[model samples]
Target: MHKLDTKLIQLCKKGNEVAQMQVYDKYAQAMFTIACRYLINEEDAKDAMQEGFLKAFVNMDSYKPDATFGAWLKRIIINQCLDVLKKRKIEFSNDEVENLKVVDDDNWDFDNSISKQNILNAIEQLNEKHKIVVQLYLVEGYDHEEISEILEIPIKTSRTHLRRGKLKLQELLKVKYNEARY
Candidate 1:
């Protein structure tokens, strides 16, 4: 990653075409996959992926290897996807947004029959804030404090979003399964 860290940035900054392609080749599929996870649409995913890369390339000089290049690039793609969703005006209300607490609930059945893809699809259906808070908490395994800092929200807000997101996801999974059975 370090080899790519320096070489890619140096070539990109120098306006090297091959280096640009190299950057695209290495990260496009991965970044696109992540974007697709958010957008749940191939074309929109591609748009976000493209924009993220363009941003990353243009700002390549600002990257430091203190973190993996892939991690940095992935953040860009996620932010791009989030931006698209935000533009759609899907958001949470104040009442729903007020509560933010994370107590381990013994009732969550991780052993349930819900297929991973179904769960992922349900997550994709969430509004941008809920979708991202869910992803950061459950998928990425980030703690509330980390999530709060990352998302620029209060700790309580992070907890609230996570709680609401999980409850919604469970409801979504139940509905989809029941519909399928019928």
Candidate 2:
């Protein structure tokens, strides 16, 4: 943490409202964008972001310097979004993939013709579980272990979902590619 951030955080911990607002102002837009990614409704995303901020403030003592304050707040925001999703009864699968060999494919290469927006649209069409896993892994840059912890599934399940999601995403993109070629 920067010296300025540390000072602000110390003030926030001391229950200074102005300091809290300053911290919120610093991170709100970026955190809101992250919430929007996990939530479809703008209002719901806003609510989640607000709730996340409240939670962070109420639990300010727990904040540590091991990670950047933004990263810590980002986790809280994502967790709040996930809580909203849970209330909607979006099921995250717990199926064990013990027998299945999940290939860890690091390459997320799409054809040159496929735009970033096209890939994002394709990701949206995936099943909810696979979509979330793919979003966390690829878009959010989380490793399998982190994903497994976040989603409360086994590491193999995370890998399996990523593999399956990647395959489906490729298929979706290929169809789009062929259509454009014709």
Candidate 3:
């Protein structure tokens, strides 16, 4: 059952603790999933979620009810995850990236045998830039234009990192499979 966003916003604005908890409970699972999509590790996702909630609660006054509460929270969580990734300083730059293409290779399929957890684990192995690009492009369904604005990177750089990151992710998955068989 979904609670009305307007009600949640009203209650939150009043500094009601119950309202805050209600908001958290309502969106916690989805928010955690969103965080995981970016961070790719359960622990990191958990951390991002907690930190995001803290930030959201502290700045609850800034929330204009015009937008859904969940959307507001999602933005904070995503930004928090990106900040942590930046602290790690994972590089994502190359002149050769100009030539990397990212056509829809829909043929690349992961059988059900490859668990979602396995795929996410493999993604976590990526550098921060690649991880961010892949999450924004493939997972969140953002285009290069939107991605450029979000990550503040050039559009070309975003596409290059995404393509390169995808190729590397596939290689990681294959290596994991081989190791599992050993």
Candidate 4:
């Protein structure tokens, strides 16, 4: 952590309300974006972000210097989002038990290039489980191991979701792009 962050954390740990607000002000927007990726509702995302901040403040004493404060807080925010989703009965399929081979490269070939917006729209239309995996792995820059831990799924399951999600995204984009050309 930078010197400023360390100072802020120390002040926050000391029960300084102003320091707590400073920390919240610094991280809230980014955290809200992360929450929105999962919740898809502005209200729910705000609620999750608030709850995350509360948890972080309450547990300030446990803050470790090993990781950046933002990273630690991001996990809490993600967990808050997941907790809300779980309460809504959102479930991931463990049914993809068969070992399906997935390509290891990022190379993609399309008949015609699709706009980034189109790709993002396709991703938004994916199944909840697949969408979350893709967002965490691709958009959020989390690795498979981190994804597994965050979602509490097996590493293999995380990989399967990501593979399947990409295939699904490709199919969606292809249809859209093909129609646009014709």
Best candidate, lDDT: 2
- Candidate 4 clashes between residue pairs 3 or more apart in a chain or in different chains: none
Taking all chains together, the TM-score of candidate 2 against the true structure is: 0.90
In TM-score terms, candidate 3 sits at: 0.72
Model 4: CA > 4 A from native? 105-116, 179-182
Tens-digit lDDT track of model 4 for 82-121: 8998788777767755766656725545454687667768
User: lDDT value for candidate 4?
Assistant: 0.86
For candidate 3, the 10 contiguous residues with the lowest summed lDDT are 99-108
lDDT (Cα atoms) of all candidates against the true structure: 0.78, 0.90, 0.79, 0.86
Error of 4 at 21 (Å): 0.6
Error (Å) of candidate 1 at residue 84 is 1.7
Kindly list the per-residue Cα lDDT of model 3 for residues 1-182, writing each as its tens digit. Answer: 13576777677888888988988998999999898777767999899899999899889889876766777788899888888876777555655765667666344477556778888787778877788887777666678898787777778888788777788998998887888788
In model 2, pairs of residues that clash are none
Q: On lDDT, who's better, 1 or 2?
A: 2
Best by TM-score: 2
The RMSD of every model to the true structure, in order and in angstroms, is: 3.4, 1.8, 3.7, 2.4
Candidate 4 is scored at a TM of 0.86
Candidate 3 segments whose C-alpha is farther than 4 A from its true place:
1-5, 36-47, 58-68, 105-113, 175-182
- Off-target runs (Cα >4 Å) in candidate 1 are 2-5, 96-101, 105-109, 112-115, 125-128, 149-152, 172-182
Higher-scoring candidate on TM-score, 1 or 2: 2
